[model samples]
Target: DQQVKQNSPSLSVQEGRISILNCDYTNSMFDYFLWYKKYPAEGPTFLISISSIKDKNEDGRFTVFLNKSAKHLSLHIVPSQPGDSAVYFCAALARGYTGNQFYFGTGTSLTVIP
Candidate 1:
């Protein structure tokens, strides 16, 4: 089974609203978490991240929250804009078969409408 997952395949929001994306992980050993945004025909771009020790991390209009005990995390985009529409992926770094590696969730596609 995948260590990380994004239950929601897609989401839509109005241009000036808040967009919320959720993610979950099964590994308790994960210490670092990151959110990446991807656009068509290009690689995923790093957005923001938070350490497991921190509950919340924010950058401009983006924020990430983590619940260690629950092994859950969420990304919030405030005042969503049309340019923000894209595939958002959540990733976690944890011990792996050989060494530490990053595991990524499937992804959540967000659409900002006017």
Candidate 2:
């Protein structure tokens, strides 16, 4: 079962436009949500994170929103740039004493057309 799912395998947008990526989870026990960006052959880098206690978090060009009732979350990037083209992975921290173990979605590749 896919506890975390990024429905869109890929997304394309024009530069300077807004890009929205969606994710869904089936595990209600997950308490921490994170978004990571990765380029080919490199490890993912943390982009933003939201704790279950909070509904939203933002950093510069990126913002993440969580809706606990729907078990859904989304990442929004404003003024999408060519540099933002990469795979975005939505991850959740497993419940119990797992020491911050993360379950990742397959990932969504974003392409910005300049």
Candidate 3:
């Protein structure tokens, strides 16, 4: 079974509105969470991340919240822009996994409209 999962396959939002993406994980040992964005014909780029110790982490327009008890996390993009439209992926890794292994969710396609 997949350790990480993104329930939503696609979502749309106004350019200036907020875009919310969600993910769930089954492993409690995952101590790090990351959100990545990918565009066509390009590799994924890291958007933001949070450690298990933190309940929330935020960047300029992106924020990630983790609920350890529920094994869920969500990413919020405020003041969304056209450039923010891309496929978003949720990934998790254990605190000290040596193989550099990451459990990744399928991905959520986000469309930001003007």
Model 3, range 7-103, lDDT digits (tens) per residue?
Answer: 9999999999999999999999899999999999999999999999999999999999999999999999999999999999999986553665788
**Worst lDDT 10-window in candidate 3:** 93-102
Error of 2 at 68 (Å): 0.6
lDDT of candidate 3 vs native?
A: 0.96
> How far off is residue 45 in model 1, in Å?
0.5
Instruction: Tell me how candidate 1 scores on lDDT.
Output: 0.97
| Candidate 1, run of 10 with poorest lDDT | 94-103
- Return the TM-score for each candidate structure: 0.96, 0.96, 0.96
Model 3 regions lying over 4 Å from their true place: 95-97
Cand. 2 TM to true fold = 0.96
lDDT of 1 by residue, 1-114 (tens): 999999999999999999999999998989999999999999999999999889999999999999999999999999999999999999999877898899999999999998
Local distance difference test values of all predictions, in order: 0.97, 0.96, 0.96
Model 2's number of clashes is: 0
- Candidate 2: 10-residue stretch with minimal lDDT: 94-103
